[model samples]
Target: MERKHELNNKKVLVVGLAKSGFAAAKVLVKYGANVIVNDMKELEKNQEAKELINQGVEVHCGSHPLSLLDKPIDFIVKNPGIPYTNPLIDAALEKEIPVFTEVELVSYLTDAEIIGITGSNGKTTTTTLVGLMMENNPKKPIVAGNIGTVLCEVADQTDVDDILVAELSSFQLMGVQSFKPHIGVLLNIFDAHLDYHGTREAYGKAKARLFMNQTEEDFCIFNADDQEVIALVENMKSKKVPFSTKQTLPKGACLNEGFVTFNDERIIAIDEIVLPGEHSLENILAATAAAKIAGADTNQIINVLKTFSGVEHRLQYVDTVEGVKFYNDSKATNILATQKAISAFNQPLILLAGGLDRGNDFDDLIPYLINTKALITFGETAPKLIKTAKEAGIKVIEHVDNVEKAVPVAYECSVSGDVVLLSPACASWDQYPSFEQRGDMFIEAVHKLR
Candidate 1:
């Protein structure tokens, strides 16, 4: 693909030298933009910053000098992780200069259509399902964003004829200005990232940006059962398509008698779906809606639905030890997520729960723990979690400093038929860097039992 000339002769500031920022800076340089890359990490430690310097782009390492923006700049390309509260970002906004993420830059880089998906949960599962559904299409589909691959990394390789399937987050979606996906898929929303977003309403408002720039020609598929999601996008301009698990919708995707359907056309039996939980069922319905709209065959849709087990770290079954099974659902970083994970099991459950204390009351998750064999809590919120379990009449409860210790405790506590589950209902920031790392520890601990 030819370089986009729109950025030529433009002075752009690329903030935060992470993957997204590095990718965006390279793309900008390719388009003849005068790129100045900024990061707080020292130059000796930042390989990406060093690479930018070698490419003739000015590198400002160890700090984001406001002086870098003192010169007239066309716009700022920011890493999605860089918050709006960052002084540079705050300064850019005050100057009326546009600040965007790599996802936005990709929207400008290519004329290809986009299929964007975002939710408090289920975004990865639904996005992966939709990408699989579109993978066989003759037009070609690329899966990127939030699900590991940065959007702009795939942008230059695509053309107007290609389609980009993106798994977006509130962090990514919150940065969009003119960026718009051809098809916007909004899964269920819940209270999340309150530390960053500040309020429940603010978080919802950030999520609502998935449909912000959509036009009449674009499509908006959302969860009909989520009153909060529905309430936010009531006046969206795009064509509204909804998927439901509670009741059959006259339009879009719906569940009826265990069969997933789209506009009354049968797709697959709910039991045939290899992924567990009613949330996964809802994801299938949502994915089917997008897949059918993308012109996937009914037979192909059914095949994928039956074969797709799930994404990693979300309700994933690890190896069993001496007749005791271990499951890794470290992706359940919130109370609602843990609730969904618990609902997927019927076996005797010995649950491992807890994480960073975000001031969340786990009261909502107590009902789901009624018949569990035991509850093992860990991380910063262990005491709070133990109290919740004891109050709910969960007989056996234990607390650990982290998941590394929780695993061994769970192993010793589990009987022959019991399932030891690690589904921490809070973020892993209190101990581990990410939920994936926490899940990895659980997997490592289980493997060590041999």
Candidate 2:
């Protein structure tokens, strides 16, 4: 791929004033692109907005009116937080204006190698792991996208030989037109972000598009354990390479007899991955598959795999006080994720669960609760969760509206050898700014109990 010399003098509308939005605006401005930014709040109220203004970027804070995008524009760069169905985006489309995500925009301008990764869970972990493995290749890879800074900012400062390991979300994948990668890693897919995508099928379609744009020269490393992803290979026309924890793949990576095997000649024992649980094992398999396909040395891959620490907020251990173990799994924003956390624990659990509901099915979680000694529900989803648990013949206790009330009740109910886990199976809009904030509050409340 060849790099473009300049992106100057083109009008680019950057929507959403979040972290990704700020990074996109900064990168576009640096490239001499005419960048117009918009957010649904005042500049003084939104920190990112104020920062962009200080950088001399023109911003329309407090709403994206039709007039904002009605003018002539080269392309519209959007943040993942803004849904595809937004009226402003729709209006831009009606006028034949092109809309690209920050990821797509970055891909268009860089000659750097890209390793795109997407899944319902462990995308951050896998993205970070891939970056670590590539560090041995002498490229000194940069991990970005949904995990940290936007990809364009990383590319702006990167040389032609550098590698980009991107953690792409379902929303980010939607705006991409032809953002193909040299190595594409598809981790296990589960029900997540249904509200933005509208349905499970729609969400899965967006994720599947990551591989749809790839060619035979590129590699699509998939999770064989996920039926949804594997099914896409059977129907799609792209180059398909599958990996799994449950079965062996003929081309990609898989677990066989307690070993992580991938490519055609590379193999490692399950212990080589050295992650926390079985789910993390799957993440390692997917990452190893992508790295091996990209020509990473087997020894370098194993060394990086063993040394990488897991990402925060996903099954994070808070503290152990007087034989009670507490975990902060605020990243489990869906029912299937909470189910995975429950399977990882063997002892009786005092599970603290709830948040802004996304119409999640509670039936899958009832068996885990029945095995537990006590269940405490909080957040706006508490009543709905309690009702569903009761229908499944499980007993649940309700607390006040937030984690502050629920954490103490869980602490009181926990006994020696019992675990108190906060793995809300819904979004955090009810009482927090983001999942990170929710996880922080849960950790702080647990500390207060100590």
Candidate 3:
């Protein structure tokens, strides 16, 4: 790892001790910074904090005491999930202390050429695709960030020749200062994470941060079909590479004569791609543009596209039980995502959906539920989803306790040639800790039916 002289002897405060916070604290110490780690979890409960304390880093746990800021803190490395409304964070901001996520630390730690991907949806899928495409390059590809592995951890091991394919979220992007990517992909934007950002404008600005540090030498691949994405990148300094599913792009990636083409060069046939859903087309175009710019040949991009099905919890096909197929789409945490998942298949769908209600009605989901034969709802949004199902003319509606309970009901409602899909159109926080856990529960429940 490159030694960051800027952090030497600096007193840096790490707020929240999750994976990112823990990684940041360790890296900070390695760069000769006096690290102070803090978390809401008790010190005994926070093994990460305990480990950091052993490394001569000062750690305060159990609570975020306002007194911790009494000392002169150079800056803060905050956990992305922690809101700005946090008492400590608000105070720090008011004091004009610089606050950032671990994402910023990555720019200081690694010399690797970064390819950052961000959007309301398709981030994981697009990042995975770009990672796979860059695998054969002389500079190895390290896929990290919000996809699972923390970017700071990957940055430590990355060399100058390496490429970091990062799946960035608005939460992570909001905290970035000078984090720039050699190739930045903005897939699409929608109304999401309003609770954290408090406004749609804030959310869009956060997503737009991917290209904020890019120069004319860098490349930015964006969705031309999304007007919001278009408007956001109008002033970007990076070379604009537009990808579209709705129209043909003369200079970027787009559909041309039934082929996925880049700059008039045919990459792959539209129908030949293995990943399901029309919504996936946007992800494909964005990844194709990014991969092509990252030195991936037509064959390399085609190879990954033809074979890769999908990322887990995002329309992943599970086992086929009694001639019925099951797809786990627990990652569909919004109406647009659920609409895409439901539209992917033509089979009679027994959709298992519902989770944390973000104060939005399910009216937008009604039109997409036309193919849905039965609706199995759960979590806090069950009533709202049930009403939507009724409006969509879904005759059979079953409100269950959770995803595990909804699976069996979905199977029971299914027949031969039918699909039992778990595509919850809300966040899983209402019942499970994360959408991954909810998807796992659905997978386990599906296996139990066998």
Q: State each model's CA lDDT, in order.
A: 0.86, 0.80, 0.91
TM-score of each: 0.95, 0.92, 0.98
What TM-score does model 3 achieve against the real structure?
0.98
lDDT of 1 by residue, 303-412 (tens): 89888888889888898889998899999989988889888888889999988998878889879996587998988889888888988899889877778888888988
Q: Which scores higher on TM-score, 2 or 3? A: 3
Candidate 3 residue pairs that clash: none
Give model 1 RMSD, 1 decimal: 1.8
| Winner on TM-score (1 vs 2) | 1
The full ranking of all candidates by lDDT, starting with the best, is 3, 1, 2
Backbone steric clashes in candidate 3, count: 0
Scored against the true structure, residue 233 in model 1 reaches a CA lDDT of 79
lDDT of 3 by residue, 1-450 (tens): 354888899889999978899889888998899888889998767889888878888888888988878999989999999999999999999999999999999878888889999999989999999999888888798999999999998898888988999999999999989888999999988999999999999999999999999999999898898899999999999999999988977899999899999999999998899999888988998998998888877788999989999999999999999999999999999988988999999989999989998899999988887789999999999998888888899999999899999888888888999999899889999899889999999999999998
Among the numbered candidates, top TM-score falls to 3
- Stretches of candidate 2 exceeding 4 Å from the true structure: 2-6, 234-239, 263-266, 271-273, 304-309, 392-396
